[model samples]
Target: MPKLARTIRFDESDAQVFSRPAEAGEWAIPGGFEFSNWTEGDLSGKARQAFANGWLSLESFGRATLVAVAQVEEAELEPLARRLADHFVQLYGAPDAEAALPIAREEIAYMVELCADHSPNVLLAVSRELTEAGVRESFRAITPAEAEIDLVAIHGSAD
Candidate 1:
């Protein structure tokens, strides 16, 4: 295969793309395809750049879909990231990254919404000491344990 501009990819194992944009927003699914809330300046150029690089389109639910893989070649990933970042600044404007200590933190929330079904649960926590010390290892790490919640729903029951 020829060298691609960006290593755009998606997993077949993952759930199908949700049908509605609002559904994706509610779930906080990362817009791995493009920037958000684009402004009038340079955003079109940025989107164009990404398309030139290697933005792949998948047909699902009569709409185009986008996704990316991290394992892409550096030549592709770098340009793709740069263009997409520019596009983000256009849409979302400036970052108001919550900051503390030595770190100027930026956060992105990703939520995958499963239609009429439940996805797996996730536990999130951060150590104060680690955060204060500017350590990132703990930020992205996950530790899951036996847990309980009230999300269960009863079906085909009469009360």
Candidate 2:
């Protein structure tokens, strides 16, 4: 089994704050690549909210304010990697799927590492800031009591 991050939503705020809100329970990653070229001015409004603390969902290319650690079966890995590779080709303009596959797998592997130390249902949030080097990201875990996430029901799948 592999552990990975899944999008979680508590209210409509995520929908309102993000240009495109990630669907609850979809596989997600820190996804700093989305803001790699952004300048200070671009980091305002909803976009800034996203840059400040959003996990990028692979399914919709949308943002989520929080993510929960979840266990994924080994069988799911290949398809997830392929889907991310396709995203690289379509969204990030990778030359081709063949060229993107390795990077996709690496990203997914990193997500697995991120979730490995946490138990299932452990909520995580990100904070980001752009520096001269590029986008820098930090993560913090929120307990269920602190987030009141037990009140929210997360559904769907990585699919």
TM-score of each: 0.23, 0.89
**Model 1 vs. true fold: TM:** 0.23
Superposition error at 8 for model 2 (Å):
0.9
lDDT of 1 at 125: 21
The C-alpha stretches of model 1 lying farther than 4 A from their native spots are 1-29, 32-71, 95-159
lDDT of 2 by residue, 1-159 (tens): 779989987777799999999999998988887899999999889999999999999888899999999999988888888998999999899999989999999988888888888889999999999999989999898767666544465554699
> Which model scores highest in TM-score?
2
- Model 2 stretches with alpha carbons more than 4 Å out: 145-159
Clashing pairs in 2: none
Reference-based lDDT, each prediction: 0.25, 0.89
RMSD of each: 15.6, 5.2
lDDT (0-100) at residue 27 of candidate 2?
89
